[model samples]
Target: MLLPSLYFEEGFKVIGNMVNTAFGKFNLTGKTALITGAAGLLGQQHASALLEIGATVVLTDISAEALGAACTALSCESTASRILTRVMDVSRAESITTVAEEFSDRRIDILVNNAAIDPKVNGDAGIQETSRLENFPLVQWELQLAVGLTGAFLCSQVFGSAMASDGRGGVILNIASDLSVFSPDQRLYRKEGLPADLQPVKPVTYSVIKAGLVGLTRYLATYWAEQGVRANALSPGGVFNGQGDEFVTRLTSLIPLGRMAKADEYQSVVQFLCTDASAYLNGQNIVMDGGRSVW
Candidate 1:
């Protein structure tokens, strides 16, 4: 029995529409996402991903010069109008509160707590003392916690409350690390011939800050579950950032995938967590470590 051509075309068109509708769950049209540390390498990538998905990205960093440069760079990929830049010092409550008030009129649907000090992976002699516990300065550890952990807490409290109060609800994506769940393999930071005591190791503060973010994720997830706000953490693996061949090879060997992550690799996961695609995901630390942690 031959169906009418018009009927067949209409049925196929309906199916196509359904698929597009489903795919649209990942779209962030009309939503605004505020990403801290937006001038940094990973922060820029996160902003790009969100902007590509039609989200209005408010890129905030402590350095005005870097933030301006990043916003300019990102403008090449997107319209200047869609990209908003702010000099936000996440370490201070006053800074967070000021930015929060400025954006209070806007409904910020997503917050990516991506600010943190990059651990000095390269064992330079000038900075060698900071990485080891015995010589790790108290001021450095306290400062790391202030920025990485305390910053997240303050942003969640202020921006998150705005989301709840507005009745729109939202998502908070904490940028954690694979170290959040597991201790850093100190061997990766070791130099070949150095004595064990004198060799550089991953700092104690890095793991503590990351682990705290994971704990914060779980707490916020449940704390605001009834208010329609969801919190989740993303624990990404080491990215290929022009490290020495020895470092890259040593790190990749430990991973089942046998390679460091490309810069753009984690963008899709950011899109997922920030959009409706991850509507039910909450309180979970999604580890995208290229199978490193498993091994």
Candidate 2:
């Protein structure tokens, strides 16, 4: 039985299209996440987690090199095709808009605002007892705010506004510091080589910026409540990769749990905030300290 050439060609095309559609629907599918600061530790972890659970992750970072490196690493994985990379300055409106447009419908399902910079601290030991506030340099404050608070607002306002209009009620998770929730009580704080004035007062422009993030999340949540968009903050405790024994000992002691938090310890908490598991959890700051702030 000879079949017509045109019929054979059409049948082949139909089969191919079915396979492609099935693969698209079944492959780590369901929602796209736009992760800002995607090169940082927490940002990488967050993106990887989402990828693990079947997400199309759009990555953005201030550094093209770092972002390229991360995207390269993710691409090597079997699921690498799910990752998208872009250079974005979260503090800038135009940058976010440019990236947002890359998504097919201008509807991003998730936004992770995880960009921040800790200000450079310069001071001498036991200077709190002697230094004056007026002597600290002003440049440090400017740098800190530029990266931390200003950047967060830029992403939130733009990404958040888009999400509000998208109608799916997307989720926003702002990475904040546990220090934002409760002030760190590191006793006998000392930094050598810092100016006397910069030493005595708490120069937590980083933490203060994070504190502002909490309020931002809440206010956005309230305004967008009717819109399907939810916003929340996840404040992590001091993440110590390898502080010296003395530094770790001094800092961990203040933590009632007696140890600094490991990086992966934050995974579960962060995943919760970013997932459907926390569908009703909105406008709240979840602190991931090991009981340090409470103590």
Please list the C-alpha lDDT of all candidates, in the order they appear.
0.91, 0.75
Q: Tell me, by TM-score, which candidate is best.
A: 1
Question: Per-residue lDDT tens digits of candidate 1, residues 248-278?
Answer: 8889999999999998899999999998888
Q: Can you give the lDDT of residue 140 in candidate 2?
A: 64
Off by over 4 Å in 2: 1-28, 76-78, 104-106, 120-136, 186-188, 191-202
Tell me the TM-score of model 2.
Answer: 0.80
> TM-scores across all candidates?
0.93, 0.80
Tell how far residue 2 is off in model 2, in angstroms. 70
Q: Report clashes for each candidate as comma-separated counts.
A: 0, 3
